[model samples]
Target: MSEHAPVEPGQVLPATELVRDRIARRWEGLNERVQAKVQSISGLDRTPEVRLIQQASSAGTVTKRVSWLRKAADHVHAGAAHLAACRKGCAHCCHIAVTISRAEAQVIARETGAKLNPKAGVFSMADSEDFGEAFKQATSGAVGKPCTFLTEGSCSIYAHRPLECRLLLNLDDDDLLCQLVEGSATNVPYLDARQHHVASVAILGQHQDYDDIRNWFPQGRANDTPSTQHKAD
Candidate 1:
């Protein structure tokens, strides 16, 4: 028997419940499709981690899966190296709003021993009115600030950077479009990031949120704090 039955012409419909159920079903369907696409990609046969993503159900497992997917996307981006204008020492695009999965953030924190500030006013796209609004809200205080991992105009965590950073490949001839202080460029090229993005989001669900890359590190490093000195002679 169906949980919901046909309603009469003048009957009060369970509109809110129906809408919520419909949205949930749609999300599940989309997640299934995204997983299928990731599984079908060539050269993933050699990647054991890709296979493990199917069995992932926990937060830690999902993070590992996302990390593997980011690496695979990096490989694909490298294959199209000729179409990209991005190079070392060109860090203009690093100033933009970059959304990342909770899993990715946790991985970065673990790797770098950085503390995460949950009250940094980061907003999730899932809760925003739209992508543009989400970007605006999440990056409110982070626009001109360089990424925390950027050192001397290069990414210090290049090997383990987030998926968003790995997939961004500027197609513009120069950095003019990326040099803009507000809004992203339209001509930037990127690998097909849909699979990884959707898969990670589906796995992370509401737990995922955006945070500025700069906020991940502790305010003061272990060496930055003043050490106690013995009484002077």
Candidate 2:
């Protein structure tokens, strides 16, 4: 596919199905092992002071840069080289507030033929000490739910998933602590990829406001493509 070509549902949907199947298989393979280990850990810090790092957006056409960011992040995840409790079906992390740039959402919409959820309003969020918690307070209704792209415990747009999703890796031994439920509030350590997140802000190489993924893509894939071509192209 050309870098500028609109992403076809056919191109992505079949792979999405395969991804779901793999996740299910992996989940089934480890369900008993993970469950057995859940009771042993207690330090799942729910209120980790998450830092929202920001930098001036950088330059690139949508495809090359997004691909670069993902590949780099994948390399980081691989080099981190620890077996994580995170598997495809274990999507507790997906339920949290995920932020993304408009460029990314447009790219995703165009690629997946997913309709863009028009923003109700536009506003800027400065880098905050507690970005997630701050977002939770400002938009009382925005988060604490599964990402729209998630389906049946697997990510429908896994390959085209945003940087926020890609970099948020849990470096724990099991899924027990990452569960966003009672008693698991203890901090679960994740791969230190804060620099990548800063790059995520800078990937587009232009100043753009970042917003929640669901705001830009509320639910469901569609035949309708994003009309604006990301407004970047």
Candidate 3:
């Protein structure tokens, strides 16, 4: 009965398909256990029309996607704005050291044409500084730094922005929602960060070997080759 219900013209759908799609893309590479999860989740796939609506909502449009996540985009933007407002032209977020997974780095490099210079792969935070100490410092002591994709005063690949960026929101100073509504604005509702993270992890975790973008690439050592040994004295 739930399978064939007639979808309304502009009605949004659940995110089961979004989960399924990602699974499909990375399925073969996943382990047997993860493959089983992927298959199980795929069984609950929603219609294509509804799936697109959810994507459109998560991207920015509130009126397009499923009901639950409609305001998600707005809230994320509001939060990001708070960190951005007083820090105008700050580029603080862009200055911190960041590590991207090989896959994600490949995506960014491919999209932006910014290659990981094999010769210039190493850069010291002390010498090759960008903005300031504050920007360089990790947020809440979290690992990874500013993304390599960040450049100048803005993002080069804003359209294909990261999931974190997509969910961030900014509230106006006068906007009472900043203080009044903790989650989701009346004009623009959004998902709580906890919920967002949980959902993302649950879905993405279904694919084995799919690493965490946050920790996929370490900022400093461990992955480096034996440089000193290879160098001539």
Clashes of each: 0, 11, 18
The lDDT for every candidate, in the order shown, is 0.52, 0.53, 0.33
Tens-digit per-residue lDDT, 41-150, candidate 1: 54444344445344443425655666556655555555444445455456655665566656677777676555666665356757756656766656665545666555
* Superposition error at 79 for model 3 (Å): 10
Model 2 TM:
0.61
TM-score top scorer: 2
Candidate 3 stretches with Cα past 4 Å from truth are: 1-88, 96-110, 113-146, 169-191, 206-233
Count clashing residue pairs in model 1: 0
Order of quality (lDDT):
2, 1, 3
Could you give candidate 3's per-residue lDDT for residues 21-105 as a string of tens digits? Answer: 5324433443453334334444533444245334643543222222233234344443344332222332333322232223333
What lDDT is obtained when candidate 2 is compared to the true structure? 0.53
TM-score of every candidate relative to the true structure: 0.60, 0.61, 0.33
